[model samples]
Target: MADERETRPQADRQLCGLVRDLASQIEAHLRTRAATLGLTPTQATALCELTHPMTLRELADRMSCEPSNITFVADRLEGQGYLERHPHPDDRRAKQLLLTPEGSELRGRLVELLSKDSPLAPLATEEQDGLRHLLTRALIR
Candidate 1:
């Protein structure tokens, strides 16, 4: 019985390994791209989330990270002239994040670099579409 169980094909293990390898490759590619932009991976991701203006808490939620982590990323990006903190139109104490001209330009370039044909792009369009569909289905649950 133990032998039968052990011999059963482990699709889950194989799929998990493939997913992990893909994720690692993406992380490495993004790290290289981030260095070229003078931004850390976290900072770049935060800026990506700011395609529209949002408050720090909102950004943190979108980033799925701690508020403090988002704050650190925001501070660094602001110092680099990639982001500006503006007074929240509705709240006296809260600040909204907006990209500077420099930030907008950088974000555009970043999008180009990470687009469908970029490193993260799958080898073929069909593969890319399939992965997207599968991942979307998985995420919806």
Candidate 2:
């Protein structure tokens, strides 16, 4: 039992390191793809998350960021003609963010770019499904 306890922490540390490394690789890939369209990683991420109109607070929550940070992102995207802000229907004090037609077009292109071949592309369909299931379970836990 003592031996098991000692190895558990080491195993957990190794798992954390592996997860971090994978996340870094994915972020680097996203950065490279975003640059092709003259967008920063954060802007690309924000655009990707805006599939439908939502409030800045909702966006911030989805992005795991502060509302102020999301404001900056929205400002940049709006300036670029990719998104627009309108008064929320029910909330006079809040604004909803929606993608412009141009934004939607660009988002489609971004999806194509991200869906292109990557490290996981070589996995068989069953393997991919299994990986997704395992990752989902891990995330929920």
Candidate 3:
């Protein structure tokens, strides 16, 4: 118990470092998987976060990026016939982004690729759930 007390103060710093390392691994894995589909990392990330039709602002918030960056990514995806913009249901001036059939297909493939050999793959299902729970709790200010 004495040793545990001595180490407790350093645990938060160590945990933060581990989280950063995990994020880096996940980003690298995403980049590699995205490349196989001819997508830039940002575009792939946007699509992954777009599982439902949502406004640019909503998607941007989910992506933790400025709406302007998503605007450009949306344009590229639209030009490629992967997505379409529609007027939001109750908002007069906002547009919601929806996946086209091609976009849905690509998103499916991307999800499949992401699931394989992912950074959390080594964790058992329950352990993964525990980690997610802890992280979400940490985020709830």
* Candidate maximizing lDDT: 3
lDDT of 3: 0.95
Please rank every candidate by lDDT, starting with the best: 3, 2, 1
Candidate 1: misplaced stretches above 4 Å?
A: 1-9, 116-119, 123-126
lDDT of 3 by residue, 9-87 (tens): 6897899999999999999999999999999999999889989999999999999989998999999999999999999
Tens digits of lDDT, candidate 2, 97-141: 999999999999997897776556788989989989988899894
Deviation in Å, model 2, residue 71 alpha carbon: 0.7
For lDDT, candidate 1 versus 3, the one ahead is 3
Q: Estimate each model's TM-score.
A: 0.84, 0.88, 0.93
- What tens digits encode model 1's per-residue C-alpha lDDT throughout 88-137? 99998999999999999999888767673465454677888888899889
Q: Rate the local accuracy (lDDT) of all candidates.
A: 0.84, 0.92, 0.95
Range of the 10 consecutive residues with the lowest summed lDDT in candidate 3:
4-13
Worst 10-residue lDDT window for candidate 2 reads 114-123
Which candidate leads in TM-score?
A: 3
- Which should have the higher TM-score, number 1 or number 2? 2
lDDT of the structure predicted as candidate 2: 0.92
